[model samples]
Target chain A: MSRLFVAMGLVLLVGASLSIGVADLWAADIDAGLVMAVSRVPRTVAAVLAGAGLALAGVVVQLSVQNRLVEPSLTGTPEAAMLGLLGITLFAPGSALLVKMGVAAAAALVGTTGFFVLATRVPQRDPILLPLVGLIYGGILGAATLWLAWATDLVQYLGTWTSGEFSGVLRGRYEVLWLIAGLAGLLWLVADRITLLSLGESHARSLGLDYRATRLLGLVIVSLVVAAVVVTVGTLPFVGLVVPNIVSRLRGDNLRTNLPFIAGLGGALILAADVLGRVVRYPYEIPAGTVFSVFGAAAFLWLLNAPRRPAHG
Target chain B: MTFETCNLSITRDGVPVLEGIDLSLPPGGITAIIGPNGAGKSTLLHAMAGLLSPHAGAVRLNGRDLSGIQPGERARSLALLTQDQGVTARLTVADLIAFGRWPHHQGRPGHEDRAAVADAIETFDLGPLAARTLDALSGGQRQRAFVAMAYAQTTPWILLDEPLSALDPRYAHDIMRRLHDLSRTGPDARSVVIVVHDLGVTARFADRVIGLKDGKLFGAGETGDLMTSDWLTRLYDTPMEVAEVGGRKIPFAA
Candidate 1:
């Protein structure tokens, strides 16, 4: 059934993508079409990769912590990456893109590690409080980024970086996102270990799984994906949180089997949203992140209200 | 394979929970650990299962120090069902049981893994509920499903922490009987160690009984010898009587 949904989604994506480039739609007008198509290709590819990476990261985080509400955004990773980007634009104004990505990746990694430390210190019995604490931590980091960007007279630049738009994702600037696909593959290789860890530390250890190591590895992977996506495009909210849950509802929570579908569906969802943004106002495009936020907020609310099954170990 | 503890001491939150506990469990029979509320029965089970690192002393599995063995290897030797089996997602009965094979097959299950899962389903009479999600089942059925997961682990030792807490009498009896039957048959016969509150069921079904009181071992011997009224009365600090009913020993408060 989910496969059917995905198939329909694919068709919708192709139609939307083609229609968005319809001004140069004819194949015979090769030069004009190539110029338009070539320009859109990198942004489209970056948006899809970001969507897929964020969604996969969200799945890993949710499963590892055994919590539904957590994602790379909620965990303060994107906030930290934003701060890193802000620092680069402020202090090292002439740094190369690779240097900027490095700073952002380091900041994201630190944020993820901080989350792990907080999780260990907080009582495991009360899990709902964990994400709340994480959100507040993220908010603080986001405030710091805002202050820095404003002080440096780069507030508008920071605004564009934080709203999660694919407009800045041009041909040369978007190649960094391919690294996320590699991270997704690595995540797949350890999918079984992550699933076992989801059974909780004690159960996983009893089964001969190195609970702490696997957990840290998962966090590192999440951080890498978040850093890559945030550096390429801004923070796309709830893709990680919503896509995994929707996929799990249709397919069981077996990470190995569901990962590819999660990636495909994630790419499709973000691409469709990006295309929708293009067509919604025609010449002037609404941000894909804004469209995702509206839809994602509704989906998130539905998930919260839906009758849920009791947890098992 | 044998399981034994040597002068084990455990502390939680700066307070000593279990003190100097020592016991040796032989293979292939059901052993019941019975005690009052704060007798540290759960602590003892956790220590034996390697869930908790004892403050002092050690646990030995089949003559090797449990601390020396790798966690994965330890998992293959023993399966522990903790007190609260809280799962956050909706998983089917077969999915839950397949978790048992995690130690053996990790996430990629093989043909033998599926066969073991099937055998576990058949053993626990969960054939009808194979496709049913765990949240959809009753408390008793859920308890049975958890036990089936442990059974699917196919280990030499199975440690259960108060599995009967939320179960009704019939389901409780059914689970105990199933464990009893499984211990006798199967390729690697399991040594079942259960923390039980009901004295009647423990007295009736258990081959051996270990009594604990106030973080200390009160008695360890055959059920027939240790389940007398005087022993139980002293153990719980309440007047009780033990009587034989329908070829099974039962305990009641006087």
Candidate 2:
């Protein structure tokens, strides 16, 4: 599709998303303008930022690993974030949100680095082995997080980050998510190098890219992006996995050309999930995480079964 | 433009691959590195191109240590196409060739870069297949495109490791002829070093031959002086003979 058409579709989704809510701006008792300014705008932007960030993270992971099956969180980013969150909640008990996010980011870096090392060890055949390893690795971190939460009586707080929902997103609470914009901009600068990485280690290095440094940088970027999303709106499972795959399948894996599409479609998919969640039971809302995974899981299955087109050697 | 290695000893995890490998290569001709398996021919090629750092001694370009050269400058000095040509991603032949211009342009390709890419496409006769992804092409076609990529780099030294190992006779000869022309033509001619199993091509096209045995330099000299039956048999540790066909000496094991 044309860029303009995609832009128009995005604008339409933004408009519809802004308008579809239980509390009407047209209601006499409610100040429509105030409601729109504070709640709707933050929630919508959160969805877009989270979506864009996760999908961008997805492409980075896939390209670096050279495996389509892997995504950001599979490498234990969210579970690591939970571990960070639980640790902070236990020790400080009243740490600032940004400080907590900082801790989460650190743990995420370690977790991601571990996954990267594991990925290098796993031979690149079947491709499914890497993700399965990541899933089990993430599960180990998850078990640790729950054990820590159970011990410290912080299970309820863990619940909040486990289920991704935008209902709690409001003014002044979600400004940290704006960092996604900066991260995305940072990604744009290194997009070309990242694409070269998919050419494999020796090939990219022979072309003068500092291959190890570039791979480490990509994983760090994935860690930071995943940390931000997990901290802001809990975990959205397949936005990172499904969106990039769709964009790559539809277009190609050239990061420069496909990044915007990946980011845009990611935003659109998340917003659609949020809208679907809100409207499905009317006043009673479902978590966007729950909604997307149900559909995202099916999409993942479809992606897995989709006959790989490229006759790769 | 002399390429030389000084007492270069390369070790992987304390196990030596190449030891006391002191040698200098004359510029502006095709040089072939011929050896048995595990003779470290590929390692020497990569080290000469500054892709591998020697555990001892140095690879020098005109007396300057290659290890001290910045990666971008090193890349501009020499282009190395490794033994494995398997690229996981499918990029078009034109785009893949354009990547050789990466060190020059980084991300921004200029007029010169465009001209070089076009020149490579024409020189390799990849015009018909330029728009097609490497995955869609036959093995020989893909190999040609890859060689064209290395050619487009405009480097003085072009190092290839077993580039024609998997090709049929026609494709093999086709590539050898093109590379022979590239290494000998004009003021901008490049020095080509290839790890080759095909002694026929080596004997016909190579100006100098470097023989490797058990990770050390066995012999290095002009093709005519070093490609004799005695040296060939000693280098391979097997009985061998050089047969003359149309005045070309082709070596064969007895």
Candidate 3:
């Protein structure tokens, strides 16, 4: 029943996303069909893909570390990707976009792996500590990225990448995000193994799961999603954390059952936020990252204070 | 088919936890591995279940070396319930039990998997609480659910590490009774090996006992013959006595 509401809400959000843009499709002088094909559709698809990818990445990180508070933003994934981009741009000025994304994905994997290692030492008794560490860790990486960008006089590029916005998305540029669709399919195929991962290593192995291999697979998927999103739409914080958490609360942690809802809700909410970003400024844009930050911050506080559910780990 | 550990020795951080230990377990009965704190009882149990790689020697199940066996095959042969397997997710009793059939079905659960889970739920009397998440259940109930999950694996061997810890006498006794019944000599009987801290419970339930002290095998024999006051006294390095009341041996510190 609730799923029907979600579906309807998603359809409405998609319609809104398609209809609203700066070009004013109804204007007689404008090439409405060309504008819709080139900008509106691609922008809408970018929002959906980036939001869904982040949400799935968040699930992977949270489950891998056995903590609920973690997301790609907190884990330094976006920062690491930005750092990698900066390095590649400095070394190879004319590198292709795909090559840049590949380097960024590798760096994100390393950064996330570092956090996973740090998570082991952090006590699991307190659910809040892991995310706090991740925040500091990401802050450090963000500082490093900023320092590199400043030294290289690439702060302008950094600004665009750090603040997620879909204004620049067009038919040709935003297509890299299509990779998230394939990754989501992969997540569905291994949904049960991922769920087993929520069970601690001992029990998971006892149930015949190759715990290390499965966790590595999850990490790789998370890195790829974060890189793809970072490359296409910049870093959108809290979409992954907030969406998966809401779905988990509503539907439980059965990833096989919750994947579609998580992905759909994430995509819809982010697209809705993007549409609001367009309408609120009226011919200007607030940047979906900025608009969603306002709402994501409030939701995050509510999630923290909301009477405690079962603490992961 | 027999389960045996041949010259099994485990070293963690260059310190031996179980050294040059060996014993073939008798089939079709409850065997309790008991020792004082840090006696490496749990370590031995984990090694036997193929969870740990021995620094020397091997654990063999049905004439196959456990180290050489694939994890899926190993899971089908034995189900291990380790202490403090954290409930990180809000998994319901039914969801957790269904995971036991993972080795057989991998991800796609068939009718046999469903039937096994149903059988396990019925066996553990968890039908009422099947829908409730693990955190919602009491300690005793949660422990029962975990045991049921291991049971649902339908393995020939079940290894448990200190399952009765923190439970009151009644819950502990109830769990032991269920295991004892399932472990009785029969075609379907499972071989049960548990790392136990309670001597009283061990005395009342365990058919055979393996005693470990300071990472060495202190003794291993039939419970009736080896659970004497003198044997336990030496094993624990404390004065101990066994009182037989109503045909049941009860061990206590003197």
Measured by DockQ, the strongest candidate is: 3
Q: Chain A TM-score of model 3 versus the true structure?
A: 0.97
lDDT of 1 by residue, A1-313 (tens): 7777786887678656655653555567567556555666776778778889999999888887777677888888998988888888778989987788888888888887787677667665665677887899899888988888778888887776778877666678889899988998898899888776667776677777888889989988887788788777888998998999898777667787788888888888888788888888887788889999899989988987894655333
lDDT of 3 at B24: 90
Ranking by lDDT: 3, 2, 1
- Residue-pair clash count for candidate 3: 0
- TM-score, each model? 0.93, 0.95, 0.97
Interface RMSDs of the predictions, in order, are: 3.5, 2.7, 3.7
* Candidate 2: residue pairs that collide: none
Ranking by TM-score: 3, 2, 1
In the range A1-313, model 2's lDDT, one tens digit per residue, is 5566667777887888899898987889999888988999999999988988999999999989888788977989899988987888778868888998888888898888888889889988678899999999999999999998898788898899888889989988888889888988888888889988988877787888999999988988888888888788998998889988887666667787788888888888888889899999998999888999998999999988984654423
lDDT (Cα, tens digit) per residue for candidate 2, span B83-198: 88546565678888988999898989899999999999999999999988766788889899999999999999999999997799889899989999999899899999999999
- DockQ of each model vs. true complex: 0.43, 0.46, 0.56
Model 1: CAPRI class: acceptable
Clashes (backbone N, CA, C under 3 Å), per candidate, total: 7, 0, 0
